[model samples]
Target: MKDGWIVNRAGLINFWYYDDEVFEFMDGRLLIRGANGSGKSVTMQSFIPLLLDGNKSPERLDPFGSRARKLEDYLLGEEALSQTNERTGYIYMEFKKQNTKNYLTIGMGLRARRGQPMDSWGFTLLDGRRVG
Candidate 1:
């Protein structure tokens, strides 16, 4: 970790929709410019999942009581699971560690049953590689 070890980009694959979306941090800021109901809040929420510690009380994460109880819940949606294929969705984040020579990629794969919690999600951390 370094001073410039910050999130530079993010991607979501079939987490909410069947398509994939990617975003890049520009000018050292992430600006979600969109109209209402355009997933601004959801996109913003996606950035915090990796930093969350589920073992701790979720009071800070769910202070509003109606936001989200878990990180997967934030990513889960009505059609989060794929109906046409066996592939589950995933969320990816890229961080520029220290300098430009090395980077860190953190990924969270999500899978859920119709009436069950999304406890099947997987988290992975890769060093010195970039995954997109």
Candidate 2:
């Protein structure tokens, strides 16, 4: 039998929420139900850049190149920024590849500065205590 690929955990900080919130996925389908502007799309689309190879910009993420115009476009707002927090925003996902014996975690962080053209961002991958 082929191994199962499941999203073990996922979360974001400052992208949609001022604080961090994590989601643990069990063995089943995930259904995100919510009202308008409930951050449903924000939570689902948060993984696109982490799972796939990209510059983590809105235009790159948009295949049609018609949706987002800049990286700051995804930033929740100036209110989401904080002097206490080192990172302006970030998204992370942890999962096990099919049939694989190892667990992988990937994440991306954003830093936006006022009046700057673009936000400074970086990506990370972690397996156990090792980092890449």
Candidate 3:
């Protein structure tokens, strides 16, 4: 069996946020603070549980447990906010082994283009393969 991994950090690129954002975990827990419409939920949900299992079903993407929202909404936004019809984004989690420099990295690469279905891929880097 492979070594156990503990989450160290997660982040987003070009999804919801125009700028890259990183969420660092303290003992596998995260506490975030921000005003309404600030994108806190989208930031966390993009990684947690999703990274753990690589399931991006609508049920898992929405924190409210509603099937109304879609991951595409985060990548390309609504008709008004989107600057381009096509775009690519990423969500990643960095994991570290207990008391060691070893790591395991997992993530998803997502692309959305108008008049087309979303294209995506999932990956894992193990045996001390860090995100660096």
Candidate 4:
């Protein structure tokens, strides 16, 4: 399969509690090492807001369950319902099969304001050709 960087993320929010953020991963394997509560899980949690319209707390039994609910509510507020911040960077993902040397790319971006409809952009490619 074609090998290349699949996902790119920048200006992440809850991921690390950092003011500004950038992260990229290829092939869907992420290697994170840091001190406890150093924001590793927080950084990962940032995506929950983006993926689920708003963030949903993980089941109470899950490690990050408490924060999940809090974050979800934060994202789904009445004025700013979008999970991702308008100023945050974008995320891109690509995939490849085990034996078939083929690749696909997916890209997405989000923009929202306190009183505006959230905006999104997405594109997909197969073998570097737009098929969907």
Candidate 5:
């Protein structure tokens, strides 16, 4: 039997260009290819450190490690796309046992209001449990 867990998928809901998107992986590998302004970076930045530890520091929101973006910017939308004063979103990654049906899932949920600081929560589920 294979000995360890492998990533099975990543999901985004109401985040960036995705109202709901699910990315499936093959043998723990996923290739995210898209055109410019197509949200490839946004998708990566939204997951990595955020899903890894639920940290929302501005620097973590950018792939360049610069504080050029904010979690609120994604939730409340940018000035031009600001259609709602408040919003919530979720990001998650799921892993499957190397040779079994068992699985583990981890995710972060973020909330933002136009004039309020952002808030977030992180969670983990085992035995294939999930939320989305």
Candidate 6:
């Protein structure tokens, strides 16, 4: 979604270690609330492998953001899924940078399949005059 952070969905893995469920993300943030061992930590751990090599740390406890896992699960589809949930929707994120009093928008809308690899896609920049 962005350079330093990402926003996406929550992925679910079946008892067999296969991803079987995905919670569609409407907003970029999620508040995981459930009893202990209800998959909150596991959901967070799923994002670790996506960070830059050194960005990952063994001491880190929870990766509670939507980006990595959602992207991973989408890009790595069926291969990552024992069963896919077609009802799932796309997870979208936009990276922002603060400049003085304004915020500048950077990357946007990175999509991935339930169990496939992250998609390599880019956006087109529009000219200011005629495109309105």
Number of the top-ranking candidate, with TM-score as the measure = 5
Comparing candidate 1 with candidate 4, which one achieves the higher TM-score?
1
Cα lDDT tens digits, model 5, 1-132, are 477988898998878767898999898899988798887887887888788766788888887788877888887678676787888988899989887788899988888888787788887897578655
Model 5: ten consecutive residues of lowest lDDT: 123-132
Total backbone collisions for each predicted model: 0, 0, 0, 7, 0, 11
Task: Give lDDT for model 5.
Answer: 0.83
> How accurate locally, in lDDT, is each candidate?
0.58, 0.60, 0.79, 0.46, 0.83, 0.36
lDDT of 3 by residue, 36-124 (tens): 87877766778876777777788898878888867787788876776778889888898887666777788888999876889999988
TM-score of 3: 0.84
Instruction: Give the TM-score of each candidate.
Output: 0.67, 0.65, 0.84, 0.45, 0.89, 0.30
Candidate rank order under TM-score: 5, 3, 1, 2, 4, 6
Clashing pairs in 2: none
Worst 10 residues of 4 by lDDT: 8-17
Compose the digit string of candidate 2's lDDT tens values, residues 1-132. 247656667767766453677777665246778998787766666666534564565655544555544556556344345333223877777676555655667777777664665455555555443221
Model 4, runs deviating above 4 Å: 1-28, 46-63, 66-88, 99-101, 115-117, 129-132
The regions of model 1 sitting more than 4 angstroms off are 1-3, 54-87
In terms of lDDT, the poorest run of 10 residues in model 1 is 51-60
Write the residue-wise lDDT of candidate 1 on 88-115 in tens digits.
6777777775556556777777665545
lDDT leader: 5
- Our model 6 lands, by Cα RMSD against the true structure, at 10.2
